[model samples]
Target: MLDLAWRPRAHLDRESIAIHLGLERKAPQAALDAMRRIDDAIERVRTFPDSGGRVRLDALRRTEYRTVLANPYTVYYRFDEKTLTVYRILHQCQNIDTYALVDLPR
Candidate 1:
C-alpha cells in the first residue's frame, strides 16, 4: 500500500470546511457529505496515484503535484516514489497559481 502524508494546510482546509458548512451554515449533513467525498477522493489517490490530473509547477524542480477534485474542493498532492504527500486542499474559488510548493519530509 502507498503511504499517505498530509501537510498541515490540508488539515486546516478540512477543518475550515467543517466549520463553514456545519457550524456557520448549519448544515451538518452537507458537511459530512463533503468530508466523505474528500475522504473518498483521498483514498482513490492513495490507491491510484495517477487518478488525479498532473499539475507541473515550474517552481518545484524535483516534485510534481497532482490535483483531484471533490466538487467545490480541490486536493493537491504529490507522490515521491514511496509516499504520497497531500499538500493542500483548496476551495475551487481560490487562486491556484498562488500556491508555492515546499520540500516535505517522507
Candidate 2:
C-alpha cells in the first residue's frame, strides 16, 4: 500500500485546527480532539486515496485532485499512481479559488 505524505501546506493546515480552536470559546482539549480526527482521516486516506471527492478546478486541466471534509475543514489531496500527496486543509467556508492550488505537485 502507498503511504500518504503531507505537503508543506498540510502542515499549515494542521495548524489551522489550533487557530480555529483558539477562536472559539471551547476548551483547549477540543482542538486536540479535532487533531486526532484529522490524524485518523489521514490514515484512512493512506489506505483509500480516492475516498475524497473529485475536485474540479477550472484553473487546472485535470480532475485528479480530491478533497475530503473533516467537519468544518476540508482536506485537499492529489494522488499520482504511486503516492498520495495531501496539499492543504482549509475551513469549509473559505473561498477555495483563492488558494490557487492548481500548481500543486502531482
lDDT of 2: 0.74
Over all chains combined, what TM-score does candidate 1 have? 0.84
**What does candidate 2's lDDT look like per residue over 1-106, in tens digits?**
5667787778877886777785665657888877877777767777788787887667543657788877777788888777888888777887777354644554
Sliding window of 10 residues with minimal summed lDDT for model 1: 97-106
Q: lDDT at 98 for candidate 1?
A: 36
Error of 2 at 101 (Å): 1.8
Clashing pairs in 2: none
Please provide, for model 1 over 1-106, each residue's C-alpha lDDT reduced to its tens digit, 9 standing for 90 to 100: 4799988778878899999999999999999999999989988988899889876555543557799999889899988678888888888898666344453454
Q: All models: lDDT? A: 0.83, 0.74
TM-score of candidate 2 against the unseen true structure: 0.78
Q: Which prediction has the highest TM-score against the true structure?
A: 1
